[model samples]
Target: MFARIFADRFVLLLLATILLASFIPVRGHAAEVASLISSAAIFLLFFLNGVRLPRHEVVSGVRNWQLQGAIFLFVFGVMSAAGLAMSHILDNILPPILALGLLFTGILPSTVQSAAAYCALARGNVAASVVAAALVNLVGVVLSPLLFALLAHVGEATVSGQAVGRIAIILLLPFALGQMAQRWCKPWVDAHKDLATWMDRISIAIAVYVAFSGAVVAGIWSIVRGDELAWLALAV
Candidate 1:
């Protein structure tokens, strides 16, 4: 059982990526190139998502307002409150930035690809999961910054027209184009759904690598001690 669990490709790949990032993170010009590649991969990932996701499913999913509302409230309200409480409780134990990072994570949206993947695995409503995840992110773009400003008393310089434009270009534009092309490409996409799944996994792995590389570049490992990491792991 342990071997079976450990042999899972996704689990192994994730650990490998983390280890790789820790040992040899991309830096300088290479980091910039990696970031661009990661962005393109993400764009392609969402584009394929648009092509594959059935319009009828999205329509039905959107109609389920109650479910969407519940997800939003849980993510933004309950989870954020819980994170704030935990930060306070661990204020003395955790670094101030780490505690703030925890709070920031709580206020974030539900991840689209992972949520939909889990829903599919559980034989749940994948369409609803996709819709809920998208809605959470759309709302989060506005709410997260405001929440940070109020709760953390941070200047909230991150949210701006440029940020919104980047979101539109990287995420919305490709998805929209894919949707427009879906009628012609749907058959091919459906026949090769496994390919799309692999692409999604690759994109996610790339994102993880980029994130960890950034943290490494910022000296996160050096600043965070072993015991502190243990506490963070337990808290997570």
Candidate 2:
């Protein structure tokens, strides 16, 4: 059972990335470079997705009201509620930012590339997944902060232009550009399906590495106690 579970090459690579982040966490200017590289990988990831999926499929997926409605409620209502509950329960044990991070994560939408890649791998509707991911994230841009303000009561909620711009550049813009270039690019992507799959995994791993490297550099291990870390992991 253990061997079967560990058979996934992606999981092994993910573990390796986490281990690398723990030991050799990037810092200062180097960390910024890593972040930029990860962002580029993500941009490429979504762009490839846009190229591969058909426009007609995207349109039809968006019009699937029942499925989209269910996802909307689950992501916004259910996930947000769960995050809030976890935040309250773990409040005593965790640092404020860490506890709040749970809610922040919950309120956020699924990543376009990662979600669509998983759906495709599972032989599911990649078009629907892509549309769903994009739709929810677009809603999340407004809803996430509103939920935080309402539940956390953290004064007036403010979103920075830089944050929104980053999301647009990394997530939305590349996908849009790819859609425009899809006429020419789609054929190539279709031919190199395996390479595209690897791109998905590589981008995801780089993202994980950059994320954990930032945490490690910030002294998360030193600040968060062992028991607290365990509980945090469990809560997550």
Candidate 3:
């Protein structure tokens, strides 16, 4: 069982990435390049997701209002409340910014591709996962900034028109284009589902690497104590 779990390439790659980032965090121009690559990989990941997702499934998924509503409530309401409670509990132990970051995470959307992929693997409702993830993100585009401003007392300028434009360009536009070409692309996509799965994993790995690299460069290890990380692990 241990070997089976470790044999999952994504898990191994993610662990390797965290270790690498701790030892040799990307900085300056290298970090910039990694950021760009991560962004491009995200676009490709979403595009492929669109190509693979059946239109009928999307339609049905959208119509599952009950499931979507539950997911939204969990993400925006319960999670946010929990984050606030945790932040207060950990404020004395954790850096203020780190506590705030934890709170901020609760207000974010459900992860899209990863959630859908996992749901499919678990023989659950993958279509609902896809729609719910997308809906949560769309709502979060507006709601997250407001929540941050209210709960964290932070400035609300983060979710501007420019941010929306970037989201549209990087996420929605590619998905839409892929959907438009789905009729012609479906066969190839179906035949090579593993390719799509690996692409998604690689994109996620790239994102994790870039994120951890930035954290390492910013002296995260120095700021966060081992006990704090242990607490974080339990909380997560």
Best by lDDT: 2
Off by over 4 Å in 3: 1-8, 120-123, 153-158
Candidates in order, TM-scores: namely 0.90, 0.90, 0.88
Q: Write the per-residue lDDT of candidate 1 for residues 18-78, one digit (tens) a residue.
A: 9999999998999999989988987887787778878888689899989998998999999
By TM-score rank, best first, the candidates go 2, 1, 3
Query: Which residue window of length 10 is worst by lDDT in model 2?
Result: 158-167
Overall lDDT per candidate, in order of appearance: 0.81, 0.86, 0.81
User: Model 2, 10-72: lDDT tens per residue?
Assistant: 789999999999999988999899988988898888899889878988889989999999999
Total colliding residue pairs, candidate 3: 0
Model 1, residue pairs in steric clash: none
Tell me which of candidates 1 and 2 scores higher on lDDT. Answer: 2
> Regarding TM-score, does 2 or 3 come out ahead?
2
What tens digits encode model 3's per-residue C-alpha lDDT throughout 1-236? 98988997767888999999999889999999999998898788778777888788878888988888889999999999888888888888777877787788877875675676567556677667867887788778899889978998866546677767776787778777878889898789899988877777787778888899999998989888898888776655
